[model samples]
Target: MCFLAESKINRIVFLSTVTDSFPKRHKGPSLTSPQRPTMRLASGHVAVQLHGEELTKIQKDFKGFGKGLVRLTPGGWLLPAPYTKFADKIYNTEFRASDVVIMTYPKCGTTWTQEVVWTMRNNPNFNHPKAGIPVKARSPFVDSDMLAHLGKDVLNSELLELVKDIVPHPDPDEGLALQLTANIPDPRTIKTHLPFSLMTPNLLDTAKVIYVARNPKDVVLSFHHHSRLMKSMSYVGSLDQYVDYFINDQLIYGPYWEHLREAWPRRDHPNMHFVFYEDMKADPMAELRKLNQFLGTDLTEEQLEKIAHYTSFEEMKRRDDFYREKEMQRLDQEVSKKDGGFFRKGEAGSWKGHLTDTQEAKINAWTKDNSQKLGITFRYSL
Candidate 1:
């Protein structure tokens, strides 16, 4: 769909290599039994499934992407069949300069941050219609669960629509359009669902990065709901299991405090910006103003108002792009709602009531360890 500059892409590739050892390989995908296969992608190319019947692998093509199979998620593979090599095929060949990378741990406010950055780059008007193109393709998350567990048929439809929606004209060679977008020379913002360690090699060194984080207590609740909607993660151990996972460092991008700690020092580094979800939720206009200022742009009151209101949780909930993502098809029709949403009720205190007293105490202790050392306290809790 959209593209990141070549230099940024190069950095992402380098970093991905640094972190590339393959996390714990999952048991084969769980395509049968009660759980079905959900297919995600290699930049909207590969099919990431849990165990399921071997459906005929379809040749889904994007302009510059290589032919990739729909395999499975990064950290999970319930299928008994071999998957690492298969996943490697897609990941190894696909990520290029054109993909705008949005890297963050799960539940760390990635979706919201991606939307903000995408709007900053692509939706200059701030008042443009949301119907013209699919937001995901324009700014996609490569590792999104939607791309991971949805069926191939559904994934194909979304991919087709995303392609048509973003470029309108399709090149017979899938990689052509992407290459063109990459070579076009303007900055393109692509979102990623990958953690910092899993990002492409060359992205950070050359391109700008904005990392969004939330307090771990809220992240746990947020991730819990997110896991419920994502079938692959639905059966992930137990609440207690997850809580321990959170503390002992078992969750995806675990050691939540550590990830932030590593990134905290760079909060004020010229190319990178660190944002807290609570801060934005509390004063969206102020956040937007600051973000715009970072990008070397200023907004008229009307423009600022447009951006702020449109991205507001209340407003984003009504938009199809924000709520009904075509890619997140594996989520249960009923339970997904219970987990809140892409734009869950945006408040800092949601954790106050939900997080157990023990959990709160642990988070307090965790924050104390580095909140001041890493400048996290100054990063904005909103």
Candidate 2:
């Protein structure tokens, strides 16, 4: 079967880590009716029924971390099991001339770049209501739930309703990238964490792609915090252990060096533009102007200034809070009052505080060695 068609098959069952601690001898009570009960893997969560071989296959394909399992795709990338099928589907999707793809490894400056690019592309007037609506809705992550949830809550907010004319809201029911492109208007802005090799060839050929790179030390630190924040991939491992996994390329969507090495040669591709996260942090306005030139958005100096102000780290954090609060209310989930919200510290070199001297040296050596192997050079710090 074609990979795309195979992706539609729901053969794999995903059971959360909470289900893994059931007593060995106790098969547990059935989940359904007294007469015809179904055996459950755990309490509270629904049981996933799978054949013996299917269960074996899933176990073989997934690597366990603390309390979560990261599914390993045939291509060797790790992802949450629920998203593996979606990731496979993304590789088969096509792209358009007007599409702008923000590609990066996770926890890089993906959200920041998304904000900058979306603002430059859509809000040329510099007066779009910058509050309430989530940045995910503005520039949907095409391979994730962001596309389906793009405008689901916009109609609830009168403030967001004003920019419906500016930002094309995608249908909530539309989950596939192909369907999303068909429905949403031109100049579609999308985000993805897939490495360059995994992305669709047509997308690379047609759409303009903005590749964002971050110092690996910062990427590892930010990713550790992010993993703990996300429920699906809850990680309780030590920073040392995490760094080991990071160095060994065992973390989800990592092997960071290889992801960069593959993308660096293509930096000069007509449709690909490389932007460093630290550079954006150093001077966002200059980066925005360069991005504007690349995208052909041609925003005036006044508009650029306005966009720079509104999308500044502080402003974006405030907006993110508004969006997160709304989501908490909508989902009826308790919010964790943590220091690292979605938009964590936007400073460069913050990794120095978190990484040990040994860890820093290891990262530096690995980065230097890999860059040389790939015939590319990178500045380690801002």
Candidate 2 positional error at 27, Å: 37
Local distance difference test, candidate 1? 0.50
RMSD of 2: 10.3
The sequence of per-residue lDDT tens digits that candidate 2 reaches over residues 222-319 is 88877665543445567887777677665667557667865788899898999998888888888888998899988888889888898899999887
lDDT of 1 by residue, 94-117 (tens): 344333455566777676676676
Q: What TM-score would every model get versus the actual structure?
A: 0.65, 0.72
Each candidate's lDDT (Cα)?
Answer: 0.50, 0.61
Best by lDDT: 2
Give me the candidate number with maximum TM-score: 2
Off by over 4 Å in 1: 1-101, 126-132, 145-156, 165-186, 236-238, 321-329, 337-339, 370-375, 378-382
Error of 1 at 324 (Å): 1.9
State residue 226's C-alpha deviation in candidate 2, in Å: 0.7
